[model samples]
Target chain A: MNILTINGISKNFGSIAALKNVSFFVPEGSVYGILGPNGSGKTTLLGIVTDVLRASSGAYKFYDGSKPVNEIRKDMGVLLETPNFYPYLSARQNLNIVAKIKGCDAAEITKALKKVNLIERQHSSFKTYSLGMKQRLAIASTLLGDPKIVILDEPTNGLDPEGISEIRQLIKLLAKEGKTIILASHLLDEVEKVCTHVAILKKGELLVSGDIDGTLSKKHGSTGENLTEQKEKTMMEVVSDDLEKLAGVLKTLNGILDINESEGVITVSCHTDELTAQQVNKHCFDNGIILSRLTVKNKNLESKFLELTK
Target chain B: MLHLLNIEFLKLQRNRSFLILIILFIVSVFGANYIVYEVSTNTGHIVHETSNKSFRLFEFPEVWQFVSFISSFLLIIPCFTVIMHTCSEYTYRTHRQNIIDGLSREQYITAKILYVVSLALFATILTVACAFFIGMLGNDPISFRDFRCVFYFFIQALTYIGLSFLLALLIKKAVLTIGIFFIYSFLIENILEKNLNRLNTGIENIGHFLPLSSSDHLLMFDILKTAMRLANIESYAPENAYLTASVIYIVLIGYACYYLYKKRDL
Candidate 1:
């Protein structure tokens, strides 16, 4: 069953359109990723679905669209944009408040804190937490009551390498438990790591959406047949000190599907059958450059978008 | 309603600013009464009935008026508390969190309305308790006469906090909402009411119809009217007139808060 179905949801702030006729469905038990850059309406769209925001025009429903939105929200946990607990309150206190709002047992607070490894420091004020800790606390709260679905917007944002890795592991674990997770992030790498289905948003528009696990070929109203045919493509992560130059040069390479640069690292999804890592390394070397790091994975989302719509 | 109150209580029980405001509220209530008592004692001229006798302001029924009047000023403490707490939910973005966690937009506003009502009731109960305590220390028989002012005080408390809630909802920031509420309710509204009252004093004194001024007029009891008669300044608007205005302002401001939260995006 689809966990959520959004229909023509549009939101506007004055004359600036934040979301324009955006629609997508999140399948139950799938890790859905909303991929976009900054100012791309990822957060705004999430805000609308979460009911904290009012859409100028449109409709949406959850879990078969039968229950009231408020009732539907009880079974779903969300961490939108930022950690939004009272700074003066302790982590435990914060979760206690959420527990009351959701009408769950008090033990859920302890379970949530322990899940995020914040049990020891749950007594600390939220204002005193590090960015990573604050994010973890938000995750802890999001996972309370073993929610059927979790919506996290940029869940790993502002985290160190270890912190990001930890959150990714936790998300993967949650997915293993059959909980549907909808994660929004600008990084293709983050989405590629955990998401099974992906939606690409650009400037308040849906560029494309499909599954990365090869099942999108028959998705409703999908032109994802080419996506299945392009299964041989590889995702390559390349990092160098000069990222802007690396990203700029990789675009000229033939058969590159998609190039995403973030934090001095360039991730390229390419046709591995036509473009080999050796060719990439040699091309950089011939251009008076050295390859610092390179790793290839099985597949990617946007590369599939480019392939499906090619 | 109880569940919503529990949610707010869970948030505020550990909050430092909220707790500090509660303390200040208690202290200010007693301090204001003590100041009035001291004036009545030290200066035979300052607080006396027109019969040339020094009337104890803390005796039985009069204690109700005295404490409720003090509570009118003390209502600022709770009103500021309401404004600060409500606006901080916006500042901290927890109102969004609350809605995300299964509160409908209506429920969210309902929770706030319940919160405002609780603060008003709390102030009212505290004033009533202080009245009983002060009246017990006096020689007059304990009576419920003049106790109706306590209910009017409750209405007055609702007006102040309801207006504060509206400002907090419309403003969505603690510092700006508190500053505007203080200046507008205390300063600007006063000037407006004074001028409006001057415009048509013969037709029920329109100044008493101002939002806070309507409630302020509720505390002009027999003693206050006697004192005003001494100054030859008539508070001619009857109690029922002020009562009607206070109730009307409370309902309108309460509905406005509900309407603002409903129509606007958080």
Candidate 2:
């Protein structure tokens, strides 16, 4: 069953179009990821879906049959932007408030806290909560009443690596329970790891979307029948402090996918089958330049997002 | 609606400001009544001694009037208190959470109205209890006749609180709305009345219709006289005109509050 169907939804603020005729379907029990750049209408799209902001045109249908939007919202859960709770209220009290609105028993509050692993600190005021805990509480609130569709925007944002791993595990567990998840995030690797299906958006337009493997393979220029003909190439992602100098040095090398600089991070994608990380580091040291970060991994979501967004 | 009302009361109970305002009003009510009792006693004794007659000055309508008069001054706290409570939902962004947590716009609005009404009733009960206690302190304690008059005055106090909350919803902020409510309800009405009286063409014709004026006059049991003074015609006294005007003001303002709250984003 289709959990959510957004049809030709467009939102504009003054002259700047936040979402331009965006359309997508969230199938039941899939971890769907929405990938976009910083100002690419990710938050706006989530806001409209969560009913916090109205769309300028178009309509969306959720899985509550033909009920009104307000009633349909009971089966849907959304966490938008930053976590917002009553700062003076304890985490338990905040969840109790959510329970009251959802018309569920307070038992669900405890259940939600347990789901987020915040039951130990449920008595702590939201003001005392770290950013990770606040986000966890937000996720807890969304899980209350056993909502069918969980929409999270930037779910693991502002978390340390450990917190990120914890949240990613939680999201995986929730999806395993058959809850449809729609994740909107700018962090490409996080989405790539967690989401089953992926959508790429740029400049308020849908660039592409499909199953993650299919979409990533298509971006890397793979045809459906050409799987056996694909060559095995080892990929390495290099992050350097001095992007211009590093790009100049990388330009003189072979076996480089491409060197791209965005904002400040310069990524040198080299085919590791011919030259390894040690070779790149040695060449950088010989050229009197320092390499800030170097790692070897497959060409993943970040590369795909950068390719589409750029 | 009952569930929403229950949630609203829970919020009101938890709010520090709401508790503080109620406590302050409770203290102010008894404190003001003590002053009224002391002054009335002194005046009654002087009248009895000078005239060589027992002056039941604190009996019947006089005690009711004295208590109600003192109460008018203290009613501002509850008015502003409820206003702040209503506007807090908007200014503090609690309204957004309220919506996110399964409250429809209508339910959200209903919760606020229920909260405002609850506060108004609470204020009215406190005012009445203070009046009853002040009556006990009088030289001639209030009879049932005086108690009935105080009951009417309590209704007027409840209306005043409701009107204040309605004004708050219309303005959607505590500071500016409550400031304007106080200035216009207390000072502007008086200044307008005095200006109208100076005109000599008609006396304060429109001042009584100003939100709190009719209720104030009705609570003091000068409804007919005040209406006559407002209309400025010599013998045309609209009987119970204060009742008519007060009812109309409450309904119209209540409707306006509902309308604006429904359309407002927050």
Candidate 3:
């Protein structure tokens, strides 16, 4: 079932577009993650969904069998940004107010507190709680009434290892219960571990999005071609004053593979993909030209993000 | 509405500062009464017993009037109240959480309005009660006889609370709103009145139309006195103008608040 649909969503702040033509769908009962940099539009997307920020132009619809988005909103709980609570109120009181506002059972408060493992600190004022505790309390508050869709933005931010693991476990457990969770984070590893599906955004534009492993696998495949095929491909970029000379000399060597010089930069692909650094240096030395820089090509999220966003 | 009210009440209950503020208000009212009673007696500004023996403590029928006067400064409470109430939401970033927790834009705004009204009414009720008890000391029987007076205090409080909410909503900063409120309430009005006094003509009357000043005049002076003052200052009276201007101010403020809230990213 489609729990949420956002079509052609665009949001602009002054002249800077925060989100542009961003469209995505969240299937029911799937853990969806939005990955992006600091200025990326992940938070903006979540904000628009929760109705905290109106999109300049877009259509968003949520459904649990033909009910309106408002009804779906009632069923979904969101935690955007940092934990915010009345400093003077106890955790239990805060959750109680949330439950009341959401028109849910007060008993759900206890259940939520238990879910976040904050039952012990439920009676403590928010001000006295630690940062991790406060974050957990926020999660607990969102989990109230057992909302199906939980959108948490950077949930484990500034947490210790133990706290991060605890929250990761909690999120996994929530997903196991068939809850639809949207985790927006800058940390790709965190998303990789917790989310079954991922969307990458850059400069208000979505770069890539789909199943986590499948998406990364496809990106990796582009860089995973055989060494000989890659060698004949002239895939490495080199910049030097004597690029023509370097290309001319590299063309005759047995392991020279393919060399293409364009705009004063020589692209050389060696037959050995995993050659020792010293061997490449000795080859450059025998060529009688400055090597400049040698880098081995590898596919990772960082490189893929750079390639797509750049 | 009940759910909104319940949430507002719960928020108020969780706010320890609110409870402390209530305690302070009660003390301030009692203290103001004691001081006024002592000062009036010492200065012979009032008689312990009237010539007719009907109205006793002071020229005014009740010492609660003095408490009400004191509560006018309690306008400071609401000014600061909305700052802590609304601006803190921005400062602490709870607004996003609030929205995510099923707070529709309308419900959030309505909740604030309801909370402000509730606290304003409570403060007004307590002040009027203080007035009632103090008036009883004058041998005037306190019961439903003075409902109008109490109701007047309620309206006065509502007006201030409304003004405070509007200011806080517009300014969106506690320090700035409180500062502006103080300047508008005390400095600007006094300066305008003094500057107009030099004219020796109708200009002072315009201060009445300004926010809070007109309401203060309506609450403090009787209709005849207000009308006469208006007539003297303007040479002609705009009978419907006062109500019209107040309504316009309220509507404009309400719309502005809603617009800002909806437009703000939060």
Best by DockQ: 1
Q: How many pairs collide in each candidate, listed in order?
A: 0, 0, 1
User: Compared with the true structure, what per-residue lDDT tens digits does model 2 show for residues B51-148?
Assistant: 88755434554566556666767878888777887777666566766776667777877787776666667766776677666666655645666454
User: Per-residue lDDT tens digits of candidate 1, residues B1-266?
Assistant: 88887788888888788899999999888788778766765664543545577565778778898888876887888988888898888889999899998888888888888988888898888888888887887778999999999999999989988998898888888889889988998799989977887785567567768888888888866777788878988656778888998898888987888888888788
What are the runs in model 3 whose C-alpha is more than 4 Å off?
Answer: A64-70, A212-303, B41-70, B140-149, B193-204, B222-248
RMSD of 2: 5.9
Interface RMSD of each: 0.8, 2.2, 1.6
Residue A52 alpha-carbon offset, candidate 2, angstroms: 3.1
lDDT of candidate 1 over A1-310, digit per residue (tens): 8999999999999999989899989888999999877898999999999988899999999977778889878878898978999999999999888888787899988988887899999999899999889998998889888899999999888889998898899889999999999999987778888989888777788767768554344342433344445446788899876887787778778888899987767888877678889888877777656779988776545555444434
TM-score winner between candidates 1 and 2: 1
| Model 3 steric clash pairs | B64-B131
Q: How many Å off is the CA of B35 in candidate 1?
A: 1.9
Q: What TM-score would you report for chain A in candidate 3?
A: 0.72
Can you give the lDDT of residue B25 in candidate 3? 72
Where's the lowest-lDDT run of ten residues in candidate 1 chain B?
B42-51
Q: How well is each residue in A29-98 modelled by candidate 3, as lDDT tens digits? A: 8899998889899888998988888899987888643664555677787778888887878999988877
Candidates ranked by lDDT: 1, 2, 3
Docking class of 1: medium
Worst 10 residues of 2 chain A by lDDT: A220-229
TM-score of chain B of 2: 0.82
